[model samples]
Target: MSEARADIYARITNEIVAAMEAGAGEWNMPWRHDGSSVARPVNLISRKPYRGINTLALWIAAHAKGYGDGVWATYRQWVERGAKVRRGEKAATVVFWKQIRGRIQETIDEADVFDVDDGRPRFVARGYAVFNRAQVDGYEEPDAPRLPESERVAHAESFFTALGIPVAYGASGAWYRVSEDRIYMPDFGRFAEPTGFYSTLAHECAHATGASHRLDRDFSRRFTKQAVAAEELVAELTAAMILADLGLAAHPRADHAAYLSSWLELLENDRRAIFTAASKAQAAADWMHARQRASAAQKESEAA
Candidate 1:
């Protein structure tokens, strides 16, 4: 990578690392799920979700400020929408890929190549500032917490159902049966707390993502403290992410909290472990979305 590109990557990764370190100390991190909505931070300008590292960056910012809504906009974008940022509200930094002018190293014919390794092509990350809707006025928030509990559960059930995993209730513990390719949980009624049932289910779902056909997360070298800890960390991160996607609180429970020391040890030993775990967790979430999109396409095909 070019020095410029290396700086961009290092800068983003370092910021995330710093946030995680700070949150771990304060217990103010996303793991606290606390039912805070992790809805996509949409750009008021385009109504499109921010991508890649920007998503995590904005999420950290919103959670830090206790922003009620995930809506965001550049200063100009808010103005264009006839909304104004409240004075003194701070802005969060985000970045996007911008292409520099000029193309390079294209061969006009199959036989025409001079060694053109020195040619320059420029694509770099450009930074900008945005304010969450909580910092703005004159525009109504789009995502109000209006979904009722029963309805919310219904939606959650439907979304997981599409993953096509068989979930069987009635076992001593909640777990994914890897050998049988099934999930087992204690009866739903046994979960006394409101979020317990969904949280347990989400954890199992994350484990299922490691099956041969999905993310293939090999935890085969188990029995060691580190191996088990790493797998648990992945599932914890995965459940938290999916819960956020479901607009539910994602705080850590006893199970997720139990491994804090292990998690911190692993992270302290390797600076990139958290990022690797996050990327893998995202792949698990993407697997669910892939099923969702395919199901939609099939329905359309049948309708047509």
Candidate 2:
């Protein structure tokens, strides 16, 4: 690896260590819920990545208090209520919401939502919001605009290389790096713009972070539903942070809806998940930033 790349990797590693030391425990995996005892092929939208019990409990409390729409406020309320229940101060209750065309509508359903008085009040739901019911709309564009092809490839290559991950172009805008010399990048024609290209590459880089030689996350092992959610949460947040640092707007994709339950559940289950994910994401951003900086320094050094 080039000295510049090496420096980038070191900087990223340092940032990660510092973030972890600062009590970044929110990355803990979440629980998963299958609708039935028999495992079936579940689509992304229907798949519940977090444990049903914990999630249901949270849903009930939040629903009863009518606090799902506001992201930060809902999270804060859940944490406060969750602590009460955990400490035997309040009980859990399940409040059912009607399912209307993939959207979770607040309704009275005895089977869907119920309350259980265990230590604290706990609420459970069979399922929360479905697709198309809740939409994420914002003032900013969903994705960053495209960049020049050459710039995209150069950026992707430099970004991964700095992390010590060798990636080459592959078909359909995909990227892969199995070994030191074996790396691939997909054809750019597969994507309409550079933002998509970089976003896809960023996802792959996140996977590389878990490589045996690196963070060794071992995603292959069947993670508790929560753990997988947590990792994905880390990946998404990291990608967004990196994208923002790169002077690009990180737009939410359609698939993000698939993890809504898990996201909410993880946050509710662990009050620290948001901060932890943010810190890790910041670490990833620092990593990418350091790499770019190193590259610039090397160019200046050569000029000097």
Quote each prediction's TM-score. Answer: 0.48, 0.40
Please report the candidate that would top TM-score against the real structure.
1
Candidate 2 per-residue lDDT, tens place, 65-173, comes to: 4222212112223333231112222333322433333333343433543333234433433433221101121111113243445655565556666665666542212
Q: How many backbone clashes does candidate 2 have?
A: 35
Looking at candidate 2, the ten consecutive residues that score lowest on lDDT are 131-140
Off by over 4 Å in 2: 1-164, 171-185, 210-225, 250-265, 302-304
List model 1 lDDT by residue over 126-190, tens digit each: 67889986676676434433224443377677778888898886443466878999997655544
User: What's model 2's overall lDDT?
Assistant: 0.44
The candidate 1 region of ten consecutive residues with least summed lDDT is 27-36
